[model samples]
Target: MSHPHPELSSPPPLGKGALRVVALGGLGEIGRNMTVFEYGGRLLIVDCGVLFPEEEQPGVDLILPDFDHIRDRLDDIEAIVLTHGHEDHIGGVPFLLRERPDIPLVGSKLTLALITAKLGEHRIKPETVLVEEGQRQDFGPFDLEFFSVNHSIPDALAVGIRTPGGSVLHTGDFKMDQLPLDGRLTDLAGFSRFGDEGVDLLLSDSTNAEQPGFVVSERDLNEDIEKVFRTADKRIVVACFASHVHRVQQVIDAASQHGRKIAFVGRSMVRNMNIARDLGYLSIPGDTIIDVKQLDKMRPNEAVLICTGSQGEPMSALSRMASRDHQIRIEEGDTILLASSLIPGNENSVNRVINGLTRWGANIVHKGNALVHVSGHASAGELLYILNMVRPRNFMPVHGEWRHMRAHAELAKKTGVSDDRIVIAEDGVVVDVYKNRAKIVGAVQAGYVYVDGSSVGDVTDAALKDRRILGEEGFISVVLAVDSNTGKILGEPEIHTRGAGLKPDAFDDVIDKLQDALDKAASDGVNDPHQLRQLVRRNAGRWVNETYRRRPMIIPVLVEV
Candidate 1:
């Protein structure tokens, strides 16, 4: 029961000044959780994270917070402090290290280890310092104290910073699970201690602010999952978040309890679990772990498989398994367990995968059907409890959508925090705190940076818009060749269409109209290559829309021979 006892070792001479806070991301969103804190001339960043791309972000691999403001003030940054190792909280480490590799990164041991592995992919070896709960360290202009917090991942932390203006507490993603699988509870006592010290401003995770009542404990899943393993006559495959070490540990324990050997699927699950086991965060007996390739040798009832892709990501091991494209095929009577929550906006994909599994005659079990998963965020009751415990003069809710933040703000008012004391923020909004007084000041560039196949921020909204158009309406390309010496038409306009849902015969009328328009335009002295290209595009686009009621992308090419 090592709780957070963040006591400053050496205190610098204090200067009562304004503390600036910036929500670079995570406000009004679910991912990309980054926040900037500045006092005097030095700055300290709490988290550098990323978000998974949604359906609208086609061809994008990851979405990151816009670091334009930080890029301009890199010299002022003192350190990067991390709360946990979940992707949304630590996914952007490599991207940030690529820009400023010299900045020191501090976090719990497992948190730093996870990011270190990520930085290795980019050939970056950053300066990393491992700090745990009860440890207090000083970074220029800031005194940081770390405390243990219960999350789905092991060794998650919350931070308290002593600034010139006052003490600021940041509760990174957490839940008050009295019976956590790891036996480490959310340090409510530590928060109360900080409250007694007169916290100036508090920034708490609002991810589950709208969720009512208490969340189910991680320990509660053990019995139900073990029952599945005990009664299953065939193989059992479980899908969960790759970073959920606690859940993975429970799955392993269940397998061992049922006399079943375990196999790890999905690249991320294998890698992250290995890291956890090597770091002593996970305990797996060598005899119980088997390779996926060896599954054929084991009896169906003697094995358990754990994989990623609980969200139904197409490339994940579970999704591929559902499609019968993976090494292990789903057989009749097999039990497929999804030990994760369905992320918002991912219902269709998850349902599709589940339907595919069901069609194969495998029994599908998920949180929707049973008590398999619990959120790692504080629900409304827990949020109110924290608000009452850590009675900070100012409050800012982070790490959720606008609705969640607003709900949490209203809850704060219920706990006696004044309306002026709670600042509702979106991405890029800056709030300044001076002597326990907080107010909205200004803003900075806090937009999305789309990552597409080795390119960062190269994809624009306009490009995505065109992609959506092409996906919906397809595209049409027209080529016209004219004599170079004389301004005369050369031949019939060559037209090509793809994915437009129209056959050549169906496009004949449009093509005839385009040819006639081209002849008329050339006769009207519109023979300039640029003008000819524009004329073809305009006429072709107009005819397609007026006739077919579809506006596909039209590409016009004018070749002067």
Candidate 2:
């Protein structure tokens, strides 16, 4: 309400005075993410992401990184290179453009497809220079190459960056999936080529670095999904991230094999389906995808509902269906398959949606109950595999919480990487690189920006506190009385309440009690709105608590009579 604080919460930018890569966010926590590698008067940002706070942040919408430290150096930001399509990796682009609108954005085809789709929602046309596997581009003196890597999403990759001082490889969120659902694998041979080409710095994802073994391949999930469809008795409802087109393709195959017609729901699901099908990345059988309005025409056993909201995004189609708001109401004996795992901070929302669906008599299947989800992050073995392939002089772990970063650094040490090469960073800590060597020079002013409704750079900590107070304490109203010629209030006060009062007629009665009190407070020969307003508020607050057994926020309005 008070013009939300400018999102750049920190003071200023401070670097290591050389080639420093600063973490704006996403080092310790999961979002408001960015990594800046600065050298030769040019800046290259790997990602800018947003991380949603836990359930405790009531009514506080999405939170983004404060770009203040880097905003002043916007001219040095040559490009923002991306690694994948996940929300945590790309969701903050619109927010980033809000601060520095001119940075050149680059990503693979599918990554750009998803981002452009998101930008379309705001009527904002994005300008992204598409990069593909085996292609390299230069940003001033920084050279970049996209090395394809397999993940839950299609076209995931690790970036190979060549700066003047040396070459740095940023292994974006990835895993080794030789037999991928999308038929692409991390090009270890390509990484080997980078090492052969003299790699100097390495940044890898730490998400699953603590997991002991290798990540499961998506190919392994196909058989399990096939069994679910072949065994399901009634309608099949598939819940997943809309951007996971490869998974969607697999589900479509399962549904088609079972002779079911797939009807996609959720904004993201529909949009991505449109993009993937048009781009030839997904293949659905003829007449397989039908209009939701025609759902009744299909037989119950042949109905497949592919919906979004796997994580209980309130507006997603599956969440609405849980509330019985969707056109295709879930019925008894329907098989609801949650094809995505619960993200760290979204367990509550996801479980709530599952509970709501179960209450409607649908049997829900998730992890442990079925083969539904597999993480795209690398496990210990896979992490080792990547480190061995890219053999760099320095290493940094990214893409996880504080624990993940620590675990990953430990893993690197265990895999023959020395402690000095592993640089553990947090949000705003800049690492300076020069002549193929790197070290943490100092810190940068990096923090988060909050986006609520149409307000960007709003919802600072102060705004969040205000929202929390409004949510918890509600609001109070006070009435004051003044003599016709003087400002004064009565001894007793009136109580007006919304959240604290149980009485239905409380506010109506409050007006009368307030007028009575005001008449008493009136000055003999003076009447003033400001003075009366203050008196009304103070008395109303005290009176409400005493008479109604509760207190609410006090707002006083005074009118001269």
Candidate 3:
């Protein structure tokens, strides 16, 4: 008889193997927001996300969770439920499905539409189950009800997965925006119903866990933005996230109110806007929004440009315009409204854009104690309110930093949630909920997988370390000859070095100093290639550090004679 590995079975089988929440990443950062609900051997994932690596991690583009622990159980992974169309929540789906095909994905109509489009970009399309708000679906052993939640992006929702353990509310990025620009609010009624229905375990967004009070309403932005638009007599280039349909709607309304035609620039902004408008999610009056190519015939005073790169993304139209390289130029009196906040890790890029706008005689505005961008996550009061609404026996805070999760957990304690009820987890940490309590159940192989261009999971720690070393020091290449039998260098050593030239003018002269050092030093009795390589590397590092104030990566090439 063939049997599965005993270790792979359910963890100790406690309390009917009751409701369990697994945080693969979202617990400790703003990006890569994902949470897993497991009950009765059925697994449903919410928001497969990816984080952008910090500056310390060079050459790495995006960081995704390593799913090897659950790779073998793909069948149990019934569906991937999305919260919104934001990159952090939906970016990793394409990479996640690369290994597991034929997986049913569940999200809102527009969310699924955006996800389908993203998959199409990869030339790999799968069946994405389009579940609207208030839609219910049942997998093998669990029942889930998804409802709309207002956020910066349209069609965002909170999920209620009902299992035998209890109903677990996975509040994806949301806020209590009563007067949302999109005219939809986070369903306090449905949430109240869940509260009335009795929730056993609650998993909520802790991204804003540290924030004290309720987040400022999204409605406040319209007043300031309307003011900006009303006063602007010249062409206005507004930058924001493409998925932020609510913000886009507000921009459209502002443009309409100002009697200015709208034109979308940048690929993603244009594509998402067209998709939303075609799907009737966004309504722009006839020729109210023109394409950039069509802008040639329109007067600049009558144009309101809505484009991507509010974060100052390099390829975005805003960046191109800032550089004065785009087909559309912002002459004097031009106004550039950076309607998005500087997402952490993108300060340099966005700051560069701001500098460029300033240099090019354009007025720029962004998040600086201003009402341009409002966060979507719930603050402390809203967090407490959700906790109180659900009245869950156990609370697991996901989607924030250690400080954030801890802050929320502490607050949960103050809100009548017992000490055992609050379980703060890190990335890959698992918490089991049974009979009104939550506790850790060890960790799984849940870490990040870096995506660098054509390579997936190629940006390894070792690679990143090597890059860091190269950046910190410089790079030294040692080419030496050794006898094959004796393991000794038979000739003079050739030392080639490049002061890790992150730029052309960074460390050009350090190579000359390294060459001088090698020319002066004599070969040692250590004929072994390995030993000689080590010696050369160590010496080169010391020399570069002392002389050029840089330590480059040292590469020793030993050729045997």
Candidate 4:
């Protein structure tokens, strides 16, 4: 397996008739999936998405793929081909479209609809092309074909791209669920056809490569969901992904079977389900769906609520309810069903939400306790099967962490692919494919572009560090008045501390030390206000760190008179 090295320099210009591929995101992590394909000086993008913020990314709303790689080349782009409607697959469309609103979007009907609705909120009316399974379209030098792939959401697809240099098949997040709720199966025959035609490179989803055996079919969860409905005594609150149309269908069926009225919660949940319903992807029984306001009129046992926040996002509806911040209160007998698998790095937040709901006397049912959730990615067995089916000359694992990609590379090798043909790379790593060979030539800047509230790409690592310090170690501010001419302290410094485990009076000893340090700096001929502020900061920071063993954010305000 080829690994990216820090010493790797910017790749030389693309060789004649060569295809250059660079993953801006979704290489080492589970989300923010964006891949740029360059052929004949034009670009083809696949899956512009976003990554949900983890706990360490304080105050971050979303993490976007750094567009610096393509910001200058946006005009060379043909279109963005979406694979599915999941947030991790299409959530970044609006942001990317903001860069160039005229860029076309290509996807299945349902996928296009979901993104279109989302873009509507951003007031972006994008140009979209709807293509179904087995359809082929040419965008510049890339001839693309779509194939049906069953996932937790309906209308998922895998794409095949044909260029003069080579042909590539990208299996966007999919599983070989023989019995999908929508009756759509992964196109093994299509993969075999590509294998027959000689696939030069294969970029496959590696999210479940570490897990053994095929993923459980979506149909297998019917009995488990039915059991939850059969036993629950009060309102059933099901939390899942807003874009999970099939899972929502299952929840709707279960609620209908139990004669309970269902209401969608969360803005995203309501909007996506409405789109799925209107597009005929999600099936709803007659009079089964009710307004959220009507939820109050129904009996406790006669209502079902489907909301977002299965991942325990702080602002999600379920999270708000768990924290007693939402209008819908959790009763003693309510059944809170977390109907989704936990994304990695979300275990702590999910557990906190679970504990909060449990404290409210609500019965909690999650994947840990029940068979209510299954992954949508293909596992080891299915990956091996696809590897054998495609028989590509080169294999690159995408959409997973290092361990998962490494495990997938082993699977590719097991299928007789040469070790030299397997390239395991992280985000920003650039690979060039020519004459049936793929090599990691270099890398680009593919760092996280944080979204905090209305700000995009403005939150730097330094700002996040300061936020973390303020949250963890607390903050301290020192106010002092000094004479400009003599650089002499005119008054005693006033100190204040928050979350530093010290009262304002506790900083008295440090104030004098700070004044003395300022006097020394002034005597040393450092009369600059900025220099004096640094002196006070250093003195107070040293004193606090030494005395309280804490390094809080020290703000020194030096006023010149």
Which model, 1 or 3, shows the larger TM-score?
A: 1
Clashing pairs in 4: none
Given candidate 3, what's the lDDT at residue 82?
Answer: 86
lDDT of 1: 0.87
Question: Which candidate, 2 or 3, would have the higher TM-score against the true structure?
Answer: 3
Ranking by TM-score: 4, 1, 3, 2
Residues 417-535, candidate 3, lDDT per residue (tens digit)? 98867776676666787765677776666667888888987677788888888777667676777678877555565666565654444344644554444444434444555666676
Residue-level lDDT tens digits of model 4 in 469-546: 999999899988888777777878888878888976787698779777876776788777787778778888889889
Give the distance in Å from residue 404's predicted Cα in candidate 4 to where it truly belongs: 0.5
Per-residue alpha-carbon lDDT of model 1 for 175-196, expressed as tens digits? 9999887788888999999899
What TM-score does structure 1 among the candidates reach? 0.95
On TM-score, the stronger of 2 and 4 is 4
Residue 395 of model 1, lDDT score: 91
lDDT for 217 in candidate 1 is 84
Q: Which stretches of candidate 3 lie over 4 Å from their true place?
A: 1-15, 482-491, 500-526, 546-549
Instruction: State TM-scores per candidate.
Output: 0.95, 0.87, 0.90, 0.98
lDDT of 2 at 284: 83
